[model samples]
Target: MACFHPLTMMLTLVLAARLAAAVPFKNESYPLTTVPGERPWNPIEPLQQRLAYINATAMAVSWNTYTSLPDEEAVVYFGTDAWELDRTAPSRQSTFETSRTFSHHAILSGLEPGTEYHYRVAHTNCFGCSTIPTYSFTTALPAGDCTPYAVAIVADMGLMGPDGLTNSTGKGAGGALLDNETNTIQSMVQSLDAYEHIVHIGDLAYADYFLKASTQGFYGADNVLTNATSIVENYERLNEAWYDQITPLTSQRPYMVAVGNHESNCNNGGVKDKVNNISYTAQICMPGQTNFTAYAEHWNMPGRPGPSQNFWYSYDVGMVHYVVLSFETDLGEGLYGPDEVGGTGKQMSGPRGKTGEQIEWLRQDLAKVDRKKTPWVLAFGHRPWYVGIADAVCEPCRLAFEGILYENNVDLVLTGHDHVYSRSVPMFNHTADPAGYDNPRAPTYITNGLGGHYDGLDVLDSPLPANVAHGIDGVYGWSRLTFANATHMRHEFVAARNSSVLDEFWLVRAREEGTCVDGEEGHTGKDNGKGHGKGGKKDKRDVLARLDE
Candidate 1:
């Protein structure tokens, strides 16, 4: 064994600590310096994705482009019929970082509700390019409409590869696929007909993994600018691939999303500059981060519109009011501190930053939900308040926000961060409601972050809590919330590979009170009588075949 002098050992430890603090991804060695005049390139033509229904009367359309056409505006042409285009809405262009790419967003307003409209997006500068096919989407019906509808909910979905699976993890382009559960995201897209819209809870592309690993050599070789450049280039490539994978679905259906830890832009310093908010706003047009980037410039979400940013807004779809919140931001919890697991932690209120807004906003937002109009209230955010995973439990977030949901009579709280699926019995303040999911006073929490990613599924920690109704791991899947009517909602978790439903439950909203009906364990997608089972049972499940038909 070799021994070192005390002073030498002290110096080494200090140097190691400095390196760890300098960059967010300690395992990767990214350049602290800039590579001038080196921008990533993409040849794909501009196509619209990330279609969001800002309201019944407005739809926000956004897309990306690598090649720029100067002095031209983005536009969308549309009408009730595909060929007879009767409307044109012009868009404003924006970019997050100079090295990234440009994104254009435009809102088509004054559309009739419950009607399908055909539309196509075109760039003003791409006159020489051929036109793309027309797409169509149905505007959401008004509250109390009692229209039966379904929505696909997922989060943490990464990129795909030549095999139509998540790209393998590697150093550069076409890295090795880390998780075999790649097909779930694509499967969701393929089965888009089963879903009226998609609520992506967060962590869309997982490009940060590439950025982090590439910035530091995968093998810790101390590679600098070269790796950093590759990081940006790889992000660009992954975005393009992800765009293609999702365009088929997003173009024709409203794809709503929330900000996750991955999309926090902590790498570039939290919505500080154009590079941070550009990509985020270009697609989702969310709230919470208004200034410091193009978020305010590109998206036009619903609710107190002046500058809410979509951070905390509620929109009605059928008989349910879907509330979107930004748990990624400092949501009044003491989660933000100097020693973040990665990157500089989210900033409190500062120059060009926002904070201490969610609880108050939520307080008012819930205060206005009229149960008579929108009988069912569902809330979604990036992080989960409760999970069986040890390191993944966010009790502080629960302490800060769960009370608001419980008080507001929120029926369901949907979240995705643990990369697994877990359903909690109707709960309040860490205690299961005595009613046992039947007319419970609290909300039912479901964590369905398993939209497939390089990180793979999270493992179950010891001593599972009693409130947990169902928990599954090592499966790639998405949840479908089918609003059968104002009084009934069916929640199903369908496996992506075999299309087997792993778990399910029903929420029965009676005129007097709401009752939660738990399905059998490993129930296998069959009628199990009112979707309620007292004892666990194992049975063969049927395949959904295909959602399109």
Candidate 2:
């Protein structure tokens, strides 16, 4: 055996680099996927999705194998530097039926933030031996201050309607209406399944209903999420109804969810667990933001997240503060919540925005608003101030909170229950003005419940105050939000049917500080502010591959 000198060690490293065809920019630019599987002639190859999502402080590392392993458990070896084999972590033993699709989510927390970590993921479950070593990512920055963030937002996706989708898939146009489509929203678990149900049920309570009756509050209490076999199975069940549906236009985007009434209802409560509510309304769980008026454990969001419970919570992404509101929560009485949970007189009187607590939080939150730091405040709920469909009390919350928004100088208001694309002129307290008199920019409003939900109220039926800018109807799609660094933000309604830009508008705030008033297109106070209503580059992760890819 030749004695390995120091120079010999260097030569060995060089030789290894030659043998391993280095893949640079892995830990840098993402979209890192595994290699393909082995062919009949080729040696057993590595699966595509080897190491899953690994964050700065956490890693969901996972792997798969063909045969059963001799060992009894699956282990993931990771470290701060490269392969520190010294310190490590072992995951719980898990086994799932494998046929091109077998996996598990292992959330590795307690990781050091803002630090580099590398390691290998291997499985020891009944399989002889298999491991994928080259996988890594820097831990995420700590939650508060400085750390940047991004998220995907979707509405009325994976829906079923009379669009004649024989497949019911809603998986980005292919894979049949209800085909073998993978999870289109893999990056973030959002779906148009409610819309799919709208279609599966023939866009009506049973059939032959207009947008008002059929799509209005289409949120059934069936707990369709529970009724379906798997999420993908649910996607397939309504195949024919929404076969060619297209979404995931926001995958790769770490976005949260804002419930649409169509999501579920007190009646749709069919989950295995006696769910307090049928709607699978997710809780952002920011600290000091929950009501916990429901159940003890399950009703409460796991992982001591940010705050708030029912739905109101503020999260930071980059320099933006996204406040997602729950329309089904308060809104007077008939809306929901409070009663089952508690009300102002009954419990606290109203939901956050509609109640004293939330209003107080809003006042303080807005009072402590550091526009210099955040620069952007975007709020989203599942109801609209205007859907173009003439309906009484369609936006009761708007009536209640528009003043709150005006007084607080809110930036934007996004809602989606009307099922149509309508961009309102920055109006305050039902007043149509483009000047955004309360602040530099009027609180912009965009209704994006278009992601292929059962098409409804395909007509402008709302009181189009002179402040109304542009509106579209029956166009199934989503809203493309571009956060162009602080001061500037743009939004466009992407039509799901043909991937076209339907209604487009933007919230352009004045750089100079002071109060500005927004009037109708006329009122001629400031610059006409006319430009290409809609034009911009597609979000790199618009429709990402959220599947076993």
Write one digit per residue (lDDT tens) for candidate 2, span 244-319. Answer: 1221211111224444333221112111122333223222111211232111111111122232442454544334
Worst 10 residues of 2 by lDDT: 195-204
Candidate 2 colliding pairs, count: 85
TM-score for candidate 1: 0.74
Q: List the global CA lDDT of all models.
A: 0.59, 0.38
Candidate 2, residue 534: lDDT = 11
RMSD of each: 15.6, 14.5
Weakest 10 consecutive residues of candidate 1 by summed lDDT: 534-543
lDDT of 2: 0.38
In order of listing, the candidates' clash counts read 18, 85
